[model samples]
Target: TESSTAQWANEDCDTQKLPFVCRRAGSVSVPAECPHEAQKPGKDIIAPGFPIHGIPCEYMLAVDAKSLVHLEILALEANPNIDFLEIYEGTMGHNLLANLTGTISNPAIYITKSANVMRVN
Candidate 1:
């Protein structure tokens, strides 16, 4: 219901559409508006929304890392033990935290496909 643009196709939404619009983009921290409740994937997940690819939004904000204003630093749920907490791909990286100290968890090893497969002897 947040997508004011979805209701109309190529028509000026200002005349007949609601102000709220849902523009879904990948790895984008800030979306146009919160995704529609019906099309929502799940709760507590920040990036849970219907992805509208190949499209852009009229109203979107960008907060550059270098230009972010420092109002005040706040404490999080974990500290001292927590090295860093980043909001990646619109989702808080809580899943990675749980597996940090387990056998199945290897944060150091990342999965990558290399073109030179025959290099390994």
Candidate 2:
């Protein structure tokens, strides 16, 4: 599923996997509030782990924690028109939601903010 869900930087974001998770590998510095694993919606989110051995532009979205619930933020090789997003809550927990209806690209994103999903870039 990680292969089929995985999408290239310029490809459609309708699937669950992406080659790059953000502008570049390790784009976001996952804070302590939001971890790369299952997260608690009502509590402070830990930052995701920065992609390891990242290339200049090539990005990666890897699981930092072992859980079924978590946001796997992928830095894009190059910032594109991120109008759509493949929200994989992980395995069967994943879902595809347009940024218009989905959450922002930020790992620290929370429902406390505007419920309307927006583009992070």
Candidate 3:
């Protein structure tokens, strides 16, 4: 089921099977490597076409092996219940640092626990 505001609808939790729809803003191709635009500090990772629709994006932020990467969400505008930002320590399967959703009133900061790799999805 689709609504004006993006949301998850469990039409039938018992017998209905629904295909997952993934959305992305713009025509940008998923890069084999991290995009250069996301490699800088203090960069904002706004949803591609924010305030309209949010697409599924995977961001891998990597730094020098000896250095640490810090991620801060300066401002976020999205449905807290449906759209969210998942932060992992190293990769997607690694330790989850935080699951951020909703309008962030206070800035959230996360530091990598191990290695210089942080995955955001």
Candidate that scores best on TM-score: 3
Candidate 2 vs candidate 3: which has greater lDDT? 3
How do all models score by TM-score? 0.14, 0.22, 0.64
Residue 37, model 1: lDDT of 35
Comparing candidate 1 with candidate 3, which one achieves the higher TM-score? 3
| CA-lDDT, candidates in order | 0.26, 0.30, 0.68
Q: Candidate 2 — worst ten consecutive residues by lDDT sum? A: 50-59
lDDT, residue 121, model 1? 5
Q: List the residue pairs that clash in candidate 3.
A: 23-55, 80-102
Off by over 4 Å in 1: 1-61, 64-67, 86-121
lDDT of 3 by residue, 2-56 (tens): 4223434335535655564444334433223334455565556655444444567
lDDT of 1 by residue, 5-85 (tens): 343234445785766554333343434454443221111222222233212111111234333211111222222343223
Off by over 4 Å in 2: 1-37, 44-78, 82-85, 88-90, 93-95, 99-121
Candidate numbers, best lDDT first, in rank order:
3, 2, 1
